[model samples]
Target: MKRYESWGRYPTIRDQKVLTISSRKAPLPLPDDERSVLPYGLGRSYGDSCVNDNNAIIDTSALSNLIAFDPNTGILRAESGVSLATILKVFVPKGWFLPVTPGTKFVTLGGAVANDIHGKNHHRAGTFGRHVSQFGLIRSSGEHLTCSPTSNSDLFRATIGGLGLTGLVTWVEIKLVSIKSPYLDTRTIKFRNLDEFVEVSRENDPVYDYSVSWVDCTTEGDQLGRGLFMAGNFSERRKSRQPKSLSIPFPCQAPSWLLNSYFMRSFNTLYYNKQLSRTVDALTHYEPFFYPLDAILDWNRMYGKRGFFQYQFVVPFDEKGETIKEIFRRITRSKRASFLAVLKTFGDIESPGIMSFPRKGITLALDFPNDGAPTLALMKELDTIVLQAGGSIYPAKDARMSHEAFLASHPRLAEFEPHIDPRFSSSFWRRVRN
Candidate 1:
């Protein structure tokens, strides 16, 4: 029996049947038992969205051929299994880059489209689905449809951010953004609280191509929401040699006590104070600027064998960001520290996908080591606050969210439900839909 797990390594599924689709022209494969199956890509999703439990999964990693590329127009067509890292390796030197990328480049093109992944530049470029020119989806009933904004438009919008419930995306055609070099001229500012952070973001977002912030989630009172704000734009100064890639391997699970609140508080203090000056500017390589966490291989293991959950939610902009501040207060009161707390604002630009998570608001993502019921309790508390604020959780990173919460957050679920392929299902879909 083969065991499979999502990137978070939680809720491991054992003895699931697997089918491989190696070619773009290959028809959808069915399990011998005739059970419903879901499309599985690189399995980078942090939760059960990519798993099917005792059922079957169609592996699409082998369908990774680049079909075509038009360097003149910055358009490229490739199989869905191609990783963003692969595209960067082959095209970054050629002066082309992904219009929008998540924190890591290890995810497959198909996964990115399915989740409608957003990045620091989301305020300007919108979600990844906005740049997708078209894609080919293979339904279980042998329907091969070409989807785009103006062609097979319904499926196109459904598949993007549909969580792979719609169908299997065989190939994706995307419009790439041109770049002069693989470097960013960055400005880093230290903010005292949420107000300072918002002010800095408002002043810089219009001018910067990319912007994100690292928030300290353990602080309270006068220092609540204090963190570093980073803004960047493509640099014209080109380097003759591409930066060398380096990764430090995490060989085994870390001790459960390793990442306790005490450790996090100490670490956060040092990290925030590392920059002595109020503001600093530098030209940095894209790798560190965008995917710093990728440098630590299998970093999820740091949460130990129990794994971790990333609670990410976006609340619409309020008069003074009071909802966000209250949520932060609850977290600090609980004394459950998050090592990687990211706070950013999404733009008004809407995504074509019916289920896309990003909206015009502030989003905060936190990594919490799973301490069983206590952790779940904290999440439930936070979910209530988000729900009241009309915010939604990112399904890609969700391991557990109530069916009611899912429906409340995604008001368009009715429209997207009819588009889901009848023969496809996933652990997450079943959990939330039920």
Candidate 2:
């Protein structure tokens, strides 16, 4: 048996049987015993949504093969196992790019659909599912489905952001956006607090094609949400020589104590002031702007062998952001600093996936080292605030959200339950359902 873990590497499971799908037309594989099965992509999901504990995982990586591409319409059809990195490498040079992309390009096409992943430009492009024209789903009952807006529409919505429970995503056909060059005209602005961050976002989100912020979670009081706001649009300048992409491994697991609050405070301070100027503008490669963390391979090891947890929740825009401030205050008070904190505003555009995480709201994501009970307690407290504020947590990045929390966050759960395939289940599904 091979050990498989999510990106977070928490709640580890060591007894899963791996099954590989080598062809798009292959039959759905199952465990010899009673254990359930779930589709496994690149394992880019930060939590257990991609894991089926003590069961079987159908590895879809081998199904990677570009089936078709129409440069004239900016549509590309490929096997679900294809990574965003592969798509960019193949189509970017031809003046086409993913219609929507998350922070990392390491995710598989099927994973993107399953999570309904959103990008910095979500205010405009919406979630990745929005750009998916259609896909092929293989169910445990030996049913091959062609899902889209017009055909098998219920399954289409359910499969998108459905956490791979509906079935195996065999192929995906997504619409791409045209780009003049593989570079972005970017502007970086410094903000002193959450208020300034919101103001900057309001002013820039409509003007730019992409926007996101990096917050310093160690600060408190008046500096509680100090961070940098980054906005960009695909540059129109003639394409220049693409820089050589580089990947540096993290080398080894860092000691857990290395990411303590004291260290995080100092690191955050230095990172915040690195720009020096309040505002800076430049032309940057899409690789760094969209996926800076990808440059550091196996970077999750930085959180140490115990692993880490990513807490991401979104409060509705109707709340006027008071909820977000309160959550920030609670995090700061806990003195549990998160070195990797991101804040972004989702636009009013809704996704077709009934279970999609993003909505019109303010979403904040933070990474906390797994310090056992203390970290779990803090997350529970934060969950209380988010649930009270009528917010939902992103299942894609969750490891331990409660059943009540899941139900409260997703009112459409009752509607989605009927669509789940009987033979499809996951560690996350079992946890939240119980």
Candidate 3:
């Protein structure tokens, strides 16, 4: 038996049976009730959604392969196990880029589809699943399901953002976007409060191709919700530019004291002040802009051996003002440290994924070090605030959300239940399932 854990590095599972499938033709049979199965990608999920503690894990990392590509039309078909990093390496030089990408390039195609992952460009391009044209899935009933907008549509909806509960996705086809250059012309705008962020984001949304912000979650009083906003678009330069090759080499886990409240407050101040000019313009490589944390591998280790929790939630656009301030007020009052706090707006483009997280709203993601009960209590309080505000928490980044909160967040859970493959299950499913 092997061990397994999500990217958060918390709640590690020590007795996992891993099945590695290297090819699509590997006639792998589905698991039965004696042992439920879950398709495991790169295990980049921040929570337990990608893990199955009681059964087996079908490791798809070995199945990475590029099945087909049409450089002229920018449509590519590849195995579900293929990583975004691999795709960028091959296509970026050819002037193509993913229509939507999360904060990390190490995630698998299937995982991206499963979570319906969004990016800074979500306000324009929508989630990753929106660009996926089709895919092939194998279910517990020994049926091969070909899913797309036109074929097996129900299964496709269920599978996307379904958290790998529908079945095992073998391969997928995606529509790539054209890029003039691998660099972006970007601007940074600092905001002092939630109202300023909302106003600035609205003003920049129509003009910029991408937008996001870094909020100071620890700040309170007049400085509450203070942050640095960034907006960018692909540069007109047609020249191909490769991303710089830099990675953190086997860094040791940091001590808990390294990221205490005092340190984080000081860090946020420095980071926010770093952008001296109100709006500085620069040309930057897409790698750093899209995946800044990727430069430091194992950066999660900085949270210490106890690991951390990534709490991400979205409230309707109308609730952008007061609700956000209340959230910040509560966080500041609790004095919990959230080192990485990002805020962004989602466009009105609705995803086909039945359980997809993003919608037309404002999202805030925070990383909090696990301090046991106190942290759980804080999250519960946040959950209440979000639910009351007609918002939803992201399951992909949650490890301790209650069943009531899950049901509240996903009002269509009943409709999605019928599509789940009986033989597929996950720690997250069990925890939140009715």
Cα TM-score per model: 0.98, 0.98, 0.97
Tens-place lDDT per residue, model 3, 243-271, is 55788744888888877888888988899
lDDT per residue, candidate 2, 150-205, as tens digits?
A: 99999999999999999999999999999999999999999999888888998999
Error of 3 at 107 (Å): 0.2
Regions of model 3 farther than 4 Å from truth? 1-3, 29-33, 239-243
Q: How many clashes (backbone N, Cα, C below 3 Å) per candidate?
A: 0, 0, 0
RMSD of candidate 2 to true structure, Å:
1.2
Q: What is the C-alpha lDDT of each candidate?
A: 0.92, 0.92, 0.88
Clashing pairs in 3: none
Give stretches of model 1 more than 4 Å off.
1-3
Q: By TM-score, is 2 or 3 better?
A: 2
lDDT of 2 at 264: 86
Model 3 gets an lDDT of 0.88
